[model samples]
Target: MTSVSIAERLGQEKFLAQTYNRDFLHVPGAFADPGGLVSFNVLSDLIARHRLEPPRLRLTVDGETLPQHRYAVPVITRRNTRWDRVHPDELHQRLAKGASLVIDQIDHLHEPVGDLAASLEGWLRAGVQVNAYASWTSTEGFGVHWDDHDVIVVQIEGAKRWRIFGPTRSLPLHRDVVEPEPPPAEPVAELVLTAGDVLYLPRGWWHAVTADQGVHSLHLTCGISPPHTGARLVGWLADELLASDIFRTDLPIHAGPEAQAAFLSALRKEVIGALDDSGLLERYAAARDAECVGRLRPSLPYVQGVPADPELMVRLTTGRARLDIVMAEGETVTRLTGAGQQVDAAPAAGPILHRLLNVGWHRLGDLADTAGVSVADTAALVAELVGAQIATVRSEGR
Candidate 1:
C-alpha cells in the first residue's frame, strides 16, 4: 500500500485548528492536483452505474430546481423495482440551456470521496457529508442562502465567483424560534475560485455562487455536522439523572405553591450536580462517538468467518471508532468501540487493532507481523471485528 497520507497533502491540521468553523478560509492552489481525487469521468461513471434517480440527482437554474421529468424517465426493472433513469440527451440539453446539476451524498457512491469524508470526520470528531455541484453557465444555481452546517468546498475544475454576505444571525439552528433578517445591500467580500482552490465557510454565512467566469464549473462541498448544543446536553443530563427518585416522581402541577417550589429546587440540584463535572462535555463526546452509526459494508465472500489468508486486506468502516486500554481484573485489556458495538481483546492485540484504525488498508500478514502473532490468530481477531460491523475484509484484487 502507498504510504502517502492525505493529511500531509492537505495541511489538514494547520487549517483545521486555526480556521475551521471560526471564519472563512480561502486557500489558493491547495489541491494542486484535484483531478486525482475526482474528475468529470468519475462523476459520469457514478451516475451510469448507480441508476441514480431524481432528487438524488437533480438540476437547478436561476435558484429554481427543475422538475425531475425534464431530464429523466421512470422505468420498471426486471426485478419489479421502479426507478428513474436519466436520459443523457435530455440531461445534456438542460445543461446546455444553463441548468446546474447536483448530486447529494456522493460520498456514499464514490470511494475516494468516502475516504475524504472519513478523514474529515476523524479530524473534526463529527459526521461529514459530501455533495457534488456542476454548472455550465453564469446563472446562479441557488441564490443567496445559508447552510445549517459548516462547509468545506474544493474547486475540482474551472472557476466560479462567490459573493459572501456576513451572517445576520448568530449560530442559527435549523429549527429556530426566529428567522434571520434579509442580507444587506452590499456583500462583505467577493472571491473567484479556480481549479485546486479551497474555501471554508462557517454555518449561517450567506453566500451566492455563479459560474459566469466564461467557463464551466465543477466542485465538491463537504458539510460538517455540528456538535452537541447546550439543549442536547441538558437532554442527556435528564437521562443521566434518572437514578434519582425526584426525577421520576410526578409533577406537582395541581399542588400548592410550596410543594411546586420544592420540586423545582430538587430538580435544579440534580441538574447542577451533573453539570458541575469538569469533564462533562468530554464524556458526552466520547459516548456519542462510541455509539455512532458508521458506514455499513458487507464482507461478501467471508460471510461466515474470515479465512486465514495472508493476502486478505482489512480496514475499519467507522471513522469515529474508539480504542482504549483498560485494566480488567488483574490483566490489561484492549477495548474497541464503534458502530454501536464493543469488543474486548487481549492487550497483545493492541498493535493490530490500532493499525486497522490508522491505516486505510493492511494485509493480514503485515498486521500479524506487527502484532507478533500467527496469521490464524490475526484472522480470528479480524473476524470478531467484522461480526461487530466495525470492520470489513476483501480479497487482494478487490
Candidate 2:
C-alpha cells in the first residue's frame, strides 16, 4: 500500500539477520496510500479483464470454496476452448453474502504486485509469489492454516483479524515425510491488521484470518520460498557430481559385497571432496541464480533486435541475476549470468549491468550514460540480454 519500495518498508539488514525464517514481525502503518499499491478498483479491473478460474480466481466461505457456477459462466469459444467468464452480478452476490475472493499468483497478472514480488525476490535472493485476498464479512477464507513458505502480508485497505497459533513443526516442507500436528485450540496471539500495515510471518506458522471489522478488506500476501537448506545443498551436489565417473558409473546391483563396498567407498570420497570446499554454498547459490526463470516476457515489435532508441526502457526481469568479474585474455571482463545464460561483456559494461540490477526500469540513454558507452553498443548489449529473456525492453510508456 506504500509508495515506498518493499525493501525500504522492510529494513533488509535488521529483518534478515534477526528475524527472517526464525520468527514473525509486524510493522503498523507501513504505507500511507494503500489504494495505490492495490485497491478495490484494481481488483475490479483484473477480474473483468482476465479469464480466471478455480485456484486462480476462487470464492470461499468459512474455508470452503463456492462452486464455479455460482459466480461465473463457462464460455466455450469457437475453437472449442472453454473458460469461466466471471459474471459481475453473480460474483458480487457471492461477495455480498460473505464469500472471500482470492486471486492467486496475482503478481503475474498485476504490475504493482509484480514489482513488489520482484523487489522481494531481489532482496531475499529467492522466488516469490503474491496472492490478492478480498473479503466483505467476518467469514474466514481458508480457516486456520499454515503455508509451506514464508509470507509478508500488506493490508491494502480495511482491516483483518489474524489469530496466530505458532508452528507445530519446524521448517515443514510441502513434500515432507511427516505432517505437522494440529494447531492449539487457543491462539498464542490475536491481532487486527488495518490499512497500511505490514506483517511478516515465517513458514510453518499456523494462522487464521477474517475481515471482522465491519468493513471490506483487500490485502496482498507476498509469499517467499524458504531459504536453501542442507537438503538443498545435497540435492545440488547430485547434479554437480554427475561429471565424476563415480557418480556416472552404474550401481553394482548384482555384484559381490567387495564390488558394492568399493563403489560406495568411491562415491563417499567424491561426495566428501565436493562438500569439503567452503565456497560450495556460494557456488550453488550462483548456479541457482543463473538458472532462475524470471518473469518471462517477449520483446515484441523488436523481435529482430533492439534499435538505438534513446527513450526506450530496459530492466532485468530476474531478481537473482549475478554479475561477476573474470579474467579474459589478460583483461577483466564482466559476466552477467541469469535466466540460464552467461553473457560476457567489456569492463565498461559493468556500470550498465549494475544499474539494471536495481529495481524498476532504466532508460536506454540513461544506461548508456551510466557506463559512458555509445547508444549503439548499449543497444547491442540490451538486445543480447533481451534475447536471453533475462531482461526486457519497453517503450517510454512505463
Residue-level lDDT of model 1, residues 84-181, one tens digit each, is 88888999999988899999988788767777777777766788888999998888889898888988888889998999997889767798888988
Candidate 2 residue-wise lDDT, 300-320, digit = tens: 788999999999989988877
In terms of TM-score, the best-performing candidate is 2
Error of 1 at 162 (Å): 1.5
The stretch of ten residues in a row with the least summed lDDT in candidate 2 is 1-10
lDDT of 2 at 140: 86
What would the TM-scores of all predictions be?
0.94, 0.95
Runs in model 2 with CA error above 4 Å? 1-4, 328-331
The lDDT per prediction is 0.84, 0.87
Going through the candidates in the order shown, the clash numbers are 0, 0
Candidate 1, which ten residues in sequence have the lowest lDDT sum?
A: 1-10
